[model samples]
Target: MTIISVYYTAKMTDADHKELLEARLADIRRVGDTVNLLTVIEEGFESNAVRSKNERNFSKEVNPYVRKSAVVGATGMMKVTVASLKMFSKREIQEFDNETSATAWLRDELEVKA
Candidate 1:
């Protein structure tokens, strides 16, 4: 199994966002060993934005390594949520609101890795 680091759980206030981003950066920078896998959990509008920005930031922070961007929110079944995710970008960023969707992505990526 690939090692993973979960950032933490919190609402996205401006200060918290700054602190979390810095901490995340530090965590990756300090990792003398490479991180093969990463997972982030987010909710709400502000949290969504924070996670989105974090994805971009972390993507830059961890160049050359493939990072998984799994956005967890109420999606699928209802077409609205899918539209929302699509709005983020043209790329099909895998999304989930619960374990089922998340695990599905995990399985898909893991198989590809194998």
Candidate 2:
């Protein structure tokens, strides 16, 4: 199984965030079915209506290409954001406290499916 990792850094502007999202989407399209690890360990998530909408759209756009997805370092409001994305995308996304565990879960999930 192919696994792709995408990281969101701390204190990103909306434009920066959108750029990363688009890049990830391109990777997903290129790779087809893939397991994804999204690390937001130091992300300073803020509530913004535009960003939220873009996130929802991204979730929808990437859903079909993602075979399994895991998120690391989602705490506080980030947890809520992840949950919302899962719901909106109707995709099962696992959450973990650290990247190692998240990657393990994603790998195991793909192995099981295989």
Top candidate, metric TM-score: 2
Per-residue lDDT tens digits for candidate 1, residues 46-73, read 3455555655565556543333444454
CA deviation > 4 Å runs, candidate 2: 109-114
TM-score for each model: 0.47, 0.80
How far residue 35's Cα lies from its native spot in candidate 2, in Å, is 3.6
TM-score of 2: 0.80
Question: Model 2 residue 87 lDDT?
Answer: 74
Error of 1 at 96 (Å): 1.8
lDDT of 2 by residue, 10-106 (tens): 7788898889888878887888565564554465666477767777787888887776678877777667888877676655687777777777777
| Range of the 10 consecutive residues with the lowest summed lDDT in candidate 2 | 105-114
